[model samples]
Target: MGSLRFISSPFSATIQDLGREALAYYAIPASGALDKKSLQLANKILGNPLHAPCIEFSFTPGKIEFESATTICLTGADMQFKVNDKIIKLNSIVGIKSGDILSGSWPKLNARCYLAVKAKLDLPNIYASYSSYPNAKIGYNSGANLKKGDQIHWKEIPLNVSLENIKVDDKPFCESIKIKKAPEYHLYSKDITDQLIANEFSIDSNSNRMGARLLEKIIGDKFPELKASVPVLPGFIQLTPSGTLIVILQDGHTTGGYPRIAYIPENELSAFNQNAPRKKFKFKLV
Candidate 1:
Protein backbone atom coordinates (compact mmCIF):
# COMPACT_ATOMS: atom_id res chain seq x y z
CA MET A 1 0.00 0.00 0.00
CA GLY A 2 1.08 3.53 -0.78
CA SER A 3 -0.20 6.90 0.40
CA LEU A 4 -0.68 10.45 -0.78
CA ARG A 5 -0.23 13.21 1.76
CA PHE A 6 -1.77 16.63 1.40
CA ILE A 7 0.89 19.21 2.04
CA SER A 8 -1.79 21.88 1.86
CA SER A 9 -5.43 21.21 1.15
CA PRO A 10 -7.74 22.88 -1.33
CA PHE A 11 -10.50 25.35 -0.48
CA SER A 12 -12.68 22.24 -0.19
CA ALA A 13 -11.73 18.62 -0.84
CA THR A 14 -13.47 15.30 -0.43
CA ILE A 15 -13.17 11.65 -1.38
CA GLN A 16 -16.02 10.75 -3.72
CA ASP A 17 -17.14 7.87 -5.88
CA LEU A 18 -20.36 7.78 -7.95
CA GLY A 19 -22.46 8.21 -4.75
CA ARG A 20 -25.25 6.13 -3.23
CA GLU A 21 -28.24 5.25 -5.36
CA ALA A 22 -31.78 3.98 -4.58
CA LEU A 23 -31.37 4.95 -0.95
CA ALA A 24 -33.70 7.95 -1.13
CA TYR A 25 -36.42 5.72 0.26
CA TYR A 26 -34.50 6.07 3.53
CA ALA A 27 -34.15 9.85 3.08
CA ILE A 28 -30.44 9.55 2.28
CA PRO A 29 -28.89 12.19 0.06
CA ALA A 30 -26.89 11.06 -2.96
CA SER A 31 -23.81 13.18 -2.39
CA GLY A 32 -21.30 12.56 -5.12
CA ALA A 33 -18.97 14.40 -7.48
CA LEU A 34 -20.74 17.49 -8.76
CA ASP A 35 -19.23 16.92 -12.21
CA LYS A 36 -19.96 13.27 -12.75
CA LYS A 37 -18.56 13.23 -16.27
CA SER A 38 -15.23 14.57 -15.12
CA LEU A 39 -14.97 11.93 -12.42
CA GLN A 40 -15.60 9.19 -14.96
CA LEU A 41 -13.12 10.62 -17.45
CA ALA A 42 -10.39 10.87 -14.86
CA ASN A 43 -10.86 7.27 -13.87
CA LYS A 44 -10.98 6.17 -17.49
CA ILE A 45 -7.53 7.64 -18.15
CA LEU A 46 -6.13 5.53 -15.35
CA GLY A 47 -7.89 2.40 -16.61
CA ASN A 48 -9.84 2.32 -13.37
CA PRO A 49 -13.53 1.62 -13.13
CA LEU A 50 -15.65 4.51 -14.33
CA HIS A 51 -17.14 4.85 -10.87
CA ALA A 52 -13.88 4.48 -8.98
CA PRO A 53 -13.18 6.73 -6.00
CA CYS A 54 -11.36 10.01 -6.67
CA ILE A 55 -10.42 13.17 -4.87
CA GLU A 56 -12.75 16.03 -5.70
CA PHE A 57 -10.93 19.32 -5.31
CA SER A 58 -12.72 22.63 -5.20
CA PHE A 59 -11.14 26.04 -5.81
CA THR A 60 -7.57 24.67 -5.47
CA PRO A 61 -5.88 21.57 -4.14
CA GLY A 62 -2.89 23.51 -2.85
CA LYS A 63 -0.27 20.77 -2.70
CA ILE A 64 0.10 17.00 -2.50
CA GLU A 65 3.04 14.64 -2.12
CA PHE A 66 3.23 11.07 -3.24
CA GLU A 67 4.60 8.69 -0.67
CA SER A 68 5.27 5.94 -3.24
CA ALA A 69 5.02 5.18 -6.93
CA THR A 70 1.58 5.36 -8.54
CA THR A 71 -0.27 6.63 -11.61
CA ILE A 72 -2.77 9.45 -11.68
CA CYS A 73 -4.92 11.52 -14.01
CA LEU A 74 -6.71 14.83 -13.61
CA THR A 75 -9.95 16.03 -15.19
CA GLY A 76 -12.54 18.76 -14.78
CA ALA A 77 -11.52 22.36 -13.92
CA ASP A 78 -8.20 23.55 -15.27
CA MET A 79 -6.40 23.86 -11.97
CA GLN A 80 -3.05 24.06 -13.83
CA PHE A 81 -1.40 21.33 -11.82
CA LYS A 82 2.39 21.17 -11.87
CA VAL A 83 5.26 19.09 -10.60
CA ASN A 84 8.78 20.44 -10.11
CA ASP A 85 7.84 23.43 -12.25
CA LYS A 86 6.60 21.13 -15.05
CA ILE A 87 2.98 21.52 -16.07
CA ILE A 88 0.91 18.32 -15.97
CA LYS A 89 -1.75 18.17 -18.65
CA LEU A 90 -5.28 17.14 -17.77
CA ASN A 91 -6.92 13.89 -18.95
CA SER A 92 -3.54 12.18 -19.33
CA ILE A 93 -1.86 9.61 -17.15
CA VAL A 94 0.99 11.02 -15.08
CA GLY A 95 3.43 8.85 -13.20
CA ILE A 96 4.21 9.69 -9.62
CA LYS A 97 7.28 8.54 -7.73
CA SER A 98 8.18 8.60 -4.10
CA GLY A 99 8.75 12.14 -2.79
CA ASP A 100 7.14 13.69 -5.88
CA ILE A 101 5.15 16.82 -5.11
CA LEU A 102 2.05 17.97 -7.00
CA SER A 103 0.51 21.40 -6.79
CA GLY A 104 -2.30 23.46 -8.32
CA SER A 105 -4.07 26.79 -8.00
CA TRP A 106 -7.63 28.06 -8.33
CA PRO A 107 -9.26 26.90 -11.56
CA LYS A 108 -9.68 29.53 -14.21
CA LEU A 109 -12.53 27.78 -15.97
CA ASN A 110 -14.68 25.37 -13.92
CA ALA A 111 -15.58 25.11 -10.22
CA ARG A 112 -14.07 21.74 -9.35
CA CYS A 113 -11.32 19.24 -10.26
CA TYR A 114 -11.22 15.46 -10.13
CA LEU A 115 -8.02 13.49 -9.50
CA ALA A 116 -8.07 9.75 -10.10
CA VAL A 117 -5.27 7.56 -8.84
CA LYS A 118 -4.49 4.11 -10.18
CA ALA A 119 -5.13 2.50 -6.85
CA LYS A 120 -7.89 1.56 -4.48
CA LEU A 121 -8.54 4.09 -1.75
CA ASP A 122 -8.74 2.62 1.71
CA LEU A 123 -12.01 4.20 2.71
CA PRO A 124 -15.00 2.47 4.22
CA ASN A 125 -18.14 2.54 2.12
CA ILE A 126 -21.33 3.93 3.67
CA TYR A 127 -24.53 2.58 2.17
CA ALA A 128 -22.43 0.98 -0.62
CA SER A 129 -20.71 4.19 -1.69
CA TYR A 130 -17.38 5.81 -0.97
CA SER A 131 -18.82 9.26 -1.64
CA SER A 132 -18.78 11.81 1.14
CA TYR A 133 -21.87 13.41 2.67
CA PRO A 134 -20.52 15.59 5.44
CA ASN A 135 -23.92 16.79 6.58
CA ALA A 136 -24.86 13.27 7.68
CA LYS A 137 -21.37 12.24 8.78
CA ILE A 138 -20.99 9.49 6.15
CA GLY A 139 -17.90 8.71 4.04
CA TYR A 140 -14.14 9.26 4.26
CA ASN A 141 -12.63 10.51 7.48
CA SER A 142 -16.01 10.14 9.13
CA GLY A 143 -17.53 12.49 6.53
CA ALA A 144 -15.14 15.33 7.27
CA ASN A 145 -13.74 17.35 4.37
CA LEU A 146 -10.09 16.82 3.55
CA LYS A 147 -7.61 19.22 5.15
CA LYS A 148 -3.88 19.92 5.07
CA GLY A 149 -1.63 17.15 6.34
CA ASP A 150 -4.20 14.46 5.73
CA GLN A 151 -2.87 11.16 4.38
CA ILE A 152 -4.89 8.80 2.20
CA HIS A 153 -3.70 5.19 1.93
CA TRP A 154 -4.42 3.01 -1.04
CA LYS A 155 -3.46 -0.26 -2.69
CA GLU A 156 -1.23 0.61 -5.61
CA ILE A 157 -1.78 -0.70 -9.12
CA PRO A 158 0.37 -3.58 -10.20
CA LEU A 159 3.49 -2.75 -12.19
CA ASN A 160 2.50 -5.18 -14.93
CA VAL A 161 -0.67 -3.26 -15.67
CA SER A 162 -0.53 -1.13 -18.80
CA LEU A 163 -1.42 2.53 -18.36
CA GLU A 164 -2.77 4.66 -21.18
CA ASN A 165 -2.19 8.38 -21.50
CA ILE A 166 -5.13 10.08 -23.11
CA LYS A 167 -5.89 13.68 -24.01
CA VAL A 168 -9.24 15.41 -24.43
CA ASP A 169 -10.01 18.99 -25.36
CA ASP A 170 -11.59 21.16 -22.72
CA LYS A 171 -15.22 21.87 -23.44
CA PRO A 172 -16.08 25.46 -24.23
CA PHE A 173 -18.35 27.27 -21.82
CA CYS A 174 -21.91 27.64 -23.08
CA GLU A 175 -23.93 30.59 -21.82
CA SER A 176 -27.22 28.84 -22.46
CA ILE A 177 -28.19 25.89 -20.26
CA LYS A 178 -31.02 23.69 -21.57
CA ILE A 179 -34.11 23.12 -19.39
CA LYS A 180 -37.54 21.49 -19.66
CA LYS A 181 -40.92 22.47 -18.26
CA ALA A 182 -41.58 20.98 -14.86
CA PRO A 183 -44.74 19.62 -13.27
CA GLU A 184 -45.67 23.04 -11.81
CA TYR A 185 -45.10 24.91 -15.07
CA HIS A 186 -48.80 25.70 -15.24
CA LEU A 187 -48.62 27.83 -12.09
CA TYR A 188 -47.02 30.71 -13.97
CA SER A 189 -48.54 32.76 -16.80
CA LYS A 190 -47.16 32.91 -20.31
CA ASP A 191 -45.61 36.32 -19.64
CA ILE A 192 -43.73 35.09 -16.57
CA THR A 193 -42.57 31.96 -18.31
CA ASP A 194 -41.51 33.97 -21.34
CA GLN A 195 -39.54 36.35 -19.11
CA LEU A 196 -37.69 33.41 -17.59
CA ILE A 197 -36.51 32.13 -20.94
CA ALA A 198 -35.71 35.60 -22.23
CA ASN A 199 -33.65 36.81 -19.29
CA GLU A 200 -30.15 35.76 -18.32
CA PHE A 201 -29.26 34.37 -14.90
CA SER A 202 -26.12 34.38 -12.80
CA ILE A 203 -25.11 31.67 -10.36
CA ASP A 204 -25.15 32.86 -6.76
CA SER A 205 -22.00 32.72 -4.65
CA ASN A 206 -23.81 30.87 -1.87
CA SER A 207 -24.42 27.90 -4.14
CA ASN A 208 -22.92 24.52 -3.23
CA ARG A 209 -23.33 20.84 -3.95
CA MET A 210 -26.83 21.00 -2.50
CA GLY A 211 -28.11 23.51 -5.04
CA ALA A 212 -27.19 26.18 -7.56
CA ARG A 213 -29.01 29.39 -6.72
CA LEU A 214 -29.63 31.69 -9.66
CA LEU A 215 -29.35 35.45 -9.03
CA GLU A 216 -32.27 36.67 -11.12
CA LYS A 217 -35.82 36.94 -9.79
CA ILE A 218 -37.77 36.09 -12.93
CA ILE A 219 -40.98 35.69 -10.99
CA GLY A 220 -41.55 39.25 -9.80
CA ASP A 221 -44.75 38.48 -7.94
CA LYS A 222 -45.16 36.22 -4.93
CA PHE A 223 -46.81 32.86 -5.65
CA PRO A 224 -48.67 30.45 -3.46
CA GLU A 225 -46.55 27.67 -1.99
CA LEU A 226 -46.93 24.09 -3.06
CA LYS A 227 -49.66 22.14 -1.21
CA ALA A 228 -47.01 19.91 0.22
CA SER A 229 -43.31 19.10 -0.18
CA VAL A 230 -42.92 17.10 -3.33
CA PRO A 231 -40.22 14.60 -4.21
CA VAL A 232 -37.26 16.28 -5.89
CA LEU A 233 -34.14 15.01 -7.61
CA PRO A 234 -30.98 16.35 -9.13
CA GLY A 235 -31.71 18.87 -11.91
CA PHE A 236 -35.10 19.90 -10.44
CA ILE A 237 -35.26 23.71 -10.55
CA GLN A 238 -37.33 25.16 -7.75
CA LEU A 239 -38.69 28.68 -7.86
CA THR A 240 -38.57 30.21 -4.42
CA PRO A 241 -41.33 32.31 -2.84
CA SER A 242 -38.95 35.29 -3.07
CA GLY A 243 -38.57 34.82 -6.84
CA THR A 244 -35.12 33.20 -6.90
CA LEU A 245 -34.39 29.93 -8.72
CA ILE A 246 -32.68 27.06 -6.97
CA VAL A 247 -31.53 24.07 -9.03
CA ILE A 248 -31.19 20.94 -6.94
CA LEU A 249 -27.86 19.15 -7.29
CA GLN A 250 -26.15 15.93 -6.21
CA ASP A 251 -26.43 16.65 -2.51
CA GLY A 252 -29.78 18.44 -2.64
CA HIS A 253 -32.75 17.42 -0.52
CA THR A 254 -34.99 14.67 -1.86
CA THR A 255 -38.06 16.82 -1.21
CA GLY A 256 -38.86 20.53 -1.63
CA GLY A 257 -41.89 22.75 -1.16
CA TYR A 258 -41.06 25.41 -3.77
CA PRO A 259 -42.57 25.51 -7.23
CA ARG A 260 -40.84 23.20 -9.66
CA ILE A 261 -40.84 25.54 -12.60
CA ALA A 262 -38.22 23.89 -14.84
CA TYR A 263 -35.40 21.39 -14.73
CA ILE A 264 -32.12 20.88 -16.53
CA PRO A 265 -31.76 17.63 -18.47
CA GLU A 266 -29.92 14.71 -16.85
CA ASN A 267 -27.14 14.71 -19.46
CA GLU A 268 -26.54 18.42 -18.95
CA LEU A 269 -26.35 18.39 -15.16
CA SER A 270 -22.56 17.92 -15.20
CA ALA A 271 -22.14 20.84 -17.57
CA PHE A 272 -24.25 23.07 -15.33
CA ASN A 273 -22.31 21.97 -12.26
CA GLN A 274 -19.17 23.43 -13.83
CA ASN A 275 -20.68 26.89 -13.86
CA ALA A 276 -18.71 28.85 -11.30
CA PRO A 277 -20.24 31.52 -9.08
CA ARG A 278 -20.92 34.83 -10.84
CA LYS A 279 -21.03 33.04 -14.22
CA LYS A 280 -24.00 34.24 -16.22
CA PHE A 281 -26.15 32.13 -18.55
CA LYS A 282 -29.56 32.05 -20.16
CA PHE A 283 -32.14 29.26 -19.93
CA LYS A 284 -32.75 27.54 -23.24
CA LEU A 285 -36.19 26.01 -22.85
CA VAL A 286 -36.66 22.73 -24.68
Candidate 2:
Protein backbone atom coordinates (compact mmCIF):
# COMPACT_ATOMS: atom_id res chain seq x y z
CA MET A 1 0.00 0.00 0.00
CA GLY A 2 1.07 3.60 -0.67
CA SER A 3 0.83 6.40 1.90
CA LEU A 4 1.11 10.13 2.60
CA ARG A 5 2.74 11.51 5.72
CA PHE A 6 1.46 14.49 7.66
CA ILE A 7 4.21 17.05 8.05
CA SER A 8 2.02 19.17 10.31
CA SER A 9 -1.66 18.80 11.01
CA PRO A 10 -4.23 21.59 10.75
CA PHE A 11 -5.94 22.97 13.84
CA SER A 12 -8.64 20.30 13.34
CA ALA A 13 -8.62 17.82 10.46
CA THR A 14 -9.86 14.27 9.87
CA ILE A 15 -10.97 11.72 7.30
CA GLN A 16 -14.78 11.68 6.84
CA ASP A 17 -17.22 9.97 4.52
CA LEU A 18 -21.06 10.00 4.38
CA GLY A 19 -21.15 8.58 7.93
CA ARG A 20 -23.07 5.61 9.40
CA GLU A 21 -26.63 5.06 8.21
CA ALA A 22 -28.25 2.41 10.40
CA LEU A 23 -26.31 2.69 13.62
CA ALA A 24 -28.35 5.45 15.22
CA TYR A 25 -30.17 2.74 17.16
CA TYR A 26 -26.96 2.34 19.14
CA ALA A 27 -26.71 6.12 19.64
CA ILE A 28 -24.00 6.49 16.95
CA PRO A 29 -24.12 9.79 15.11
CA ALA A 30 -24.10 9.92 11.33
CA SER A 31 -20.82 11.83 11.53
CA GLY A 32 -20.17 12.61 7.89
CA ALA A 33 -18.60 15.63 6.15
CA LEU A 34 -19.97 18.93 7.37
CA ASP A 35 -20.12 20.09 3.76
CA LYS A 36 -21.25 17.19 1.62
CA LYS A 37 -21.67 19.14 -1.61
CA SER A 38 -18.07 20.28 -1.48
CA LEU A 39 -16.85 16.87 -0.45
CA GLN A 40 -18.69 15.39 -3.42
CA LEU A 41 -17.13 17.93 -5.76
CA ALA A 42 -13.65 17.03 -4.57
CA ASN A 43 -14.39 13.34 -5.04
CA LYS A 44 -15.96 13.92 -8.44
CA ILE A 45 -12.84 15.70 -9.65
CA LEU A 46 -10.77 12.68 -8.63
CA GLY A 47 -13.34 10.22 -10.06
CA ASN A 48 -13.96 8.80 -6.62
CA PRO A 49 -17.37 7.98 -5.15
CA LEU A 50 -19.25 10.91 -3.64
CA HIS A 51 -19.11 9.24 -0.23
CA ALA A 52 -15.42 8.40 -0.52
CA PRO A 53 -13.38 9.59 2.45
CA CYS A 54 -11.75 13.04 2.33
CA ILE A 55 -9.95 15.36 4.71
CA GLU A 56 -12.14 17.97 6.48
CA PHE A 57 -10.30 20.87 8.12
CA SER A 58 -11.52 23.76 10.18
CA PHE A 59 -10.00 27.05 11.44
CA THR A 60 -6.16 27.08 11.14
CA PRO A 61 -4.35 25.82 8.08
CA GLY A 62 -1.57 23.22 8.09
CA LYS A 63 0.65 21.08 5.84
CA ILE A 64 0.86 17.58 4.41
CA GLU A 65 3.42 15.79 2.21
CA PHE A 66 3.11 13.07 -0.39
CA GLU A 67 5.40 10.05 -0.19
CA SER A 68 3.96 8.95 -3.55
CA ALA A 69 2.65 10.80 -6.62
CA THR A 70 -1.14 11.23 -6.81
CA THR A 71 -3.94 13.57 -7.83
CA ILE A 72 -5.71 15.75 -5.25
CA CYS A 73 -8.32 18.49 -5.05
CA LEU A 74 -9.38 20.93 -2.34
CA THR A 75 -13.00 21.97 -2.26
CA GLY A 76 -15.20 24.05 0.04
CA ALA A 77 -13.84 27.06 1.99
CA ASP A 78 -11.01 28.03 -0.34
CA MET A 79 -7.78 26.83 1.28
CA GLN A 80 -5.43 28.81 -0.99
CA PHE A 81 -2.97 25.93 -0.82
CA LYS A 82 0.45 25.66 -2.50
CA VAL A 83 2.06 22.56 -3.87
CA ASN A 84 5.86 22.57 -4.17
CA ASP A 85 5.81 26.07 -2.61
CA LYS A 86 3.87 27.54 -5.57
CA ILE A 87 0.34 28.79 -4.92
CA ILE A 88 -2.52 26.74 -6.38
CA LYS A 89 -6.23 27.50 -6.63
CA LEU A 90 -8.95 25.92 -4.55
CA ASN A 91 -11.74 23.71 -6.04
CA SER A 92 -9.28 22.72 -8.76
CA ILE A 93 -7.57 19.39 -9.33
CA VAL A 94 -3.79 19.41 -8.96
CA GLY A 95 -0.95 16.97 -9.17
CA ILE A 96 1.54 16.07 -6.45
CA LYS A 97 4.88 14.32 -6.55
CA SER A 98 6.64 12.17 -4.00
CA GLY A 99 8.04 14.48 -1.27
CA ASP A 100 5.91 17.42 -2.42
CA ILE A 101 4.25 19.49 0.32
CA LEU A 102 0.89 21.33 0.32
CA SER A 103 0.15 23.97 2.91
CA GLY A 104 -1.95 27.12 3.42
CA SER A 105 -4.10 29.20 5.77
CA TRP A 106 -7.88 29.34 6.29
CA PRO A 107 -10.22 30.79 3.71
CA LYS A 108 -11.80 34.20 4.11
CA LEU A 109 -15.37 33.11 3.40
CA ASN A 110 -15.98 29.77 5.15
CA ALA A 111 -14.82 27.63 8.04
CA ARG A 112 -14.77 24.00 6.83
CA CYS A 113 -12.80 22.70 3.78
CA TYR A 114 -12.48 19.33 2.08
CA LEU A 115 -9.36 17.72 0.54
CA ALA A 116 -10.14 14.77 -1.71
CA VAL A 117 -7.50 12.51 -3.20
CA LYS A 118 -7.59 10.01 -6.06
CA ALA A 119 -7.32 7.22 -3.52
CA LYS A 120 -9.19 6.64 -0.29
CA LEU A 121 -7.64 6.92 3.14
CA ASP A 122 -7.15 3.53 4.74
CA LEU A 123 -9.47 3.82 7.75
CA PRO A 124 -11.25 1.49 10.10
CA ASN A 125 -14.95 0.95 9.41
CA ILE A 126 -17.82 1.25 11.87
CA TYR A 127 -21.25 0.19 10.62
CA ALA A 128 -19.90 0.48 7.05
CA SER A 129 -18.62 4.04 7.39
CA TYR A 130 -15.19 5.64 7.42
CA SER A 131 -16.36 8.85 9.09
CA SER A 132 -14.58 9.85 12.28
CA TYR A 133 -16.85 10.21 15.33
CA PRO A 134 -14.61 10.95 18.30
CA ASN A 135 -17.66 11.10 20.56
CA ALA A 136 -18.64 7.55 19.67
CA LYS A 137 -15.16 6.03 19.42
CA ILE A 138 -15.82 5.02 15.79
CA GLY A 139 -14.00 5.17 12.43
CA TYR A 140 -10.35 6.20 11.77
CA ASN A 141 -7.95 6.13 14.75
CA SER A 142 -10.81 5.49 17.15
CA GLY A 143 -12.43 8.65 15.82
CA ALA A 144 -9.41 10.87 16.43
CA ASN A 145 -8.62 14.11 14.56
CA LEU A 146 -5.59 14.23 12.29
CA LYS A 147 -2.40 14.97 14.19
CA LYS A 148 1.25 15.70 13.36
CA GLY A 149 3.37 12.81 12.09
CA ASP A 150 0.28 10.83 11.09
CA GLN A 151 0.61 8.50 8.12
CA ILE A 152 -2.41 8.26 5.75
CA HIS A 153 -2.37 4.98 3.81
CA TRP A 154 -3.62 4.60 0.26
CA LYS A 155 -3.14 2.19 -2.64
CA GLU A 156 -0.88 3.05 -5.61
CA ILE A 157 -2.51 4.50 -8.70
CA PRO A 158 -1.62 4.85 -12.42
CA LEU A 159 0.61 7.71 -13.53
CA ASN A 160 -2.09 9.16 -15.81
CA VAL A 161 -4.29 10.06 -12.84
CA SER A 162 -1.76 12.57 -11.52
CA LEU A 163 -1.43 14.34 -14.88
CA GLU A 164 -5.10 15.37 -15.07
CA ASN A 165 -6.09 18.95 -14.25
CA ILE A 166 -9.66 20.20 -14.08
CA LYS A 167 -11.65 23.20 -12.88
CA VAL A 168 -15.03 23.30 -11.09
CA ASP A 169 -17.66 25.82 -10.03
CA ASP A 170 -17.17 26.99 -6.45
CA LYS A 171 -20.35 28.99 -6.01
CA PRO A 172 -21.82 29.37 -2.55
CA PHE A 173 -24.95 27.74 -1.21
CA CYS A 174 -28.13 29.64 -0.34
CA GLU A 175 -27.94 32.15 2.49
CA SER A 176 -31.57 31.64 3.51
CA ILE A 177 -32.30 28.28 5.11
CA LYS A 178 -35.67 26.63 4.53
CA ILE A 179 -37.07 24.84 7.56
CA LYS A 180 -40.36 23.18 8.48
CA LYS A 181 -42.17 22.96 11.77
CA ALA A 182 -41.07 20.07 13.96
CA PRO A 183 -42.93 17.81 16.37
CA GLU A 184 -42.55 20.34 19.16
CA TYR A 185 -42.99 23.44 17.08
CA HIS A 186 -46.08 24.38 19.06
CA LEU A 187 -43.99 24.63 22.21
CA TYR A 188 -42.73 28.03 21.08
CA SER A 189 -45.11 30.94 21.59
CA LYS A 190 -46.29 33.16 18.76
CA ASP A 191 -43.64 35.71 19.64
CA ILE A 192 -40.87 33.14 19.72
CA THR A 193 -41.85 31.62 16.37
CA ASP A 194 -42.28 35.06 14.84
CA GLN A 195 -38.88 36.14 16.06
CA LEU A 196 -37.22 33.05 14.62
CA ILE A 197 -38.59 33.75 11.18
CA ALA A 198 -38.24 37.52 11.22
CA ASN A 199 -34.85 37.89 12.84
CA GLU A 200 -31.41 37.03 11.51
CA PHE A 201 -29.41 34.68 13.71
CA SER A 202 -25.67 34.28 13.90
CA ILE A 203 -23.56 31.23 14.63
CA ASP A 204 -21.76 31.31 17.95
CA SER A 205 -18.15 30.18 18.44
CA ASN A 206 -19.53 27.34 20.56
CA SER A 207 -20.91 25.68 17.41
CA ASN A 208 -19.43 22.33 16.38
CA ARG A 209 -20.32 18.97 14.80
CA MET A 210 -22.59 18.18 17.72
CA GLY A 211 -24.67 21.38 17.63
CA ALA A 212 -24.59 25.18 17.71
CA ARG A 213 -25.98 27.81 20.03
CA LEU A 214 -27.49 30.78 18.26
CA LEU A 215 -26.63 34.32 19.25
CA GLU A 216 -30.30 35.24 19.48
CA LYS A 217 -31.94 34.40 22.80
CA ILE A 218 -35.66 33.78 23.05
CA ILE A 219 -36.67 34.31 26.64
CA GLY A 220 -40.26 34.32 27.87
CA ASP A 221 -42.53 32.59 30.34
CA LYS A 222 -44.60 31.00 27.56
CA PHE A 223 -41.72 28.64 26.77
CA PRO A 224 -42.54 25.01 27.39
CA GLU A 225 -40.83 23.12 30.17
CA LEU A 226 -38.25 20.45 29.30
CA LYS A 227 -39.69 17.31 27.79
CA ALA A 228 -38.75 13.64 27.75
CA SER A 229 -35.91 12.58 25.48
CA VAL A 230 -36.90 11.85 21.91
CA PRO A 231 -35.16 10.99 18.65
CA VAL A 232 -34.19 14.02 16.64
CA LEU A 233 -32.47 14.63 13.30
CA PRO A 234 -29.45 16.70 12.60
CA GLY A 235 -30.35 20.37 12.07
CA PHE A 236 -33.26 20.17 14.45
CA ILE A 237 -33.58 23.46 16.31
CA GLN A 238 -34.13 22.98 20.01
CA LEU A 239 -34.62 25.57 22.74
CA THR A 240 -32.63 25.05 25.90
CA PRO A 241 -33.75 25.83 29.44
CA SER A 242 -31.68 29.02 29.30
CA GLY A 243 -33.79 30.28 26.41
CA THR A 244 -30.91 29.81 23.94
CA LEU A 245 -31.51 28.35 20.50
CA ILE A 246 -29.38 25.29 19.79
CA VAL A 247 -29.29 24.06 16.19
CA ILE A 248 -28.12 20.49 15.90
CA LEU A 249 -25.37 19.52 13.42
CA GLN A 250 -23.90 16.44 11.75
CA ASP A 251 -22.69 14.76 14.93
CA GLY A 252 -25.69 15.54 17.18
CA HIS A 253 -27.02 12.88 19.46
CA THR A 254 -29.91 10.69 18.31
CA THR A 255 -32.06 11.51 21.30
CA GLY A 256 -32.38 14.85 23.06
CA GLY A 257 -34.52 16.17 25.87
CA TYR A 258 -34.95 19.58 24.31
CA PRO A 259 -38.01 20.34 22.23
CA ARG A 260 -37.34 20.24 18.47
CA ILE A 261 -39.09 23.28 17.07
CA ALA A 262 -37.88 23.32 13.48
CA TYR A 263 -36.32 21.14 10.83
CA ILE A 264 -33.11 22.17 9.07
CA PRO A 265 -32.70 19.58 6.32
CA GLU A 266 -29.59 17.42 6.25
CA ASN A 267 -28.75 18.51 2.72
CA GLU A 268 -28.59 22.11 3.84
CA LEU A 269 -26.17 21.41 6.69
CA SER A 270 -23.22 21.96 4.30
CA ALA A 271 -24.33 25.52 3.79
CA PHE A 272 -24.57 26.05 7.53
CA ASN A 273 -21.08 24.63 8.08
CA GLN A 274 -19.66 27.22 5.68
CA ASN A 275 -20.99 30.00 7.87
CA ALA A 276 -18.27 31.55 10.01
CA PRO A 277 -18.94 32.62 13.58
CA ARG A 278 -21.28 35.61 13.74
CA LYS A 279 -22.31 35.05 10.11
CA LYS A 280 -26.01 35.87 9.91
CA PHE A 281 -28.84 34.08 8.09
CA LYS A 282 -32.61 34.06 8.19
CA PHE A 283 -34.82 31.02 8.58
CA LYS A 284 -37.89 30.67 6.38
CA LEU A 285 -40.61 28.24 7.32
CA VAL A 286 -41.84 25.98 4.59
Writing each residue's lDDT as its tens digit, candidate 1 over 1-286 gives 9998988867888988888999887778888888888999888777888999999987788789999988898999988999758999988778888999999988776888899999988998888899988778898787787988889999987633343454565783567899999999888888878978999888898887788898878766666588899999899999888888899988889999898999998778888888777788888998
User: TM-score for every candidate vs. truth?
Assistant: 0.94, 0.92
What is the C-alpha lDDT profile of model 2 across 1-46, one tens digit per residue? 6678778878888788887788778887888988888888888777
Q: Indicate the worst ten consecutive residues by lDDT in candidate 2.
A: 158-167
Worst 10 residues of 1 by lDDT: 158-167
Backbone clashes in model 1, listed as residue pairs: none
Per-residue lDDT of 91 in model 2: 69
| lDDT of candidate model 1 versus the reference | 0.85
lDDT of 1 at 268: 85
- The Cα error of candidate 1 at residue 66, in Å, is 1.3
CA RMSD of all predictions: 1.8, 2.3
Best by TM-score: 1
**Native-to-model Cα distance after best TM-score fit, residue 218 in candidate 2, in Å:** 2.1
lDDT of each: 0.85, 0.81
Error of 2 at 281 (Å): 1.6
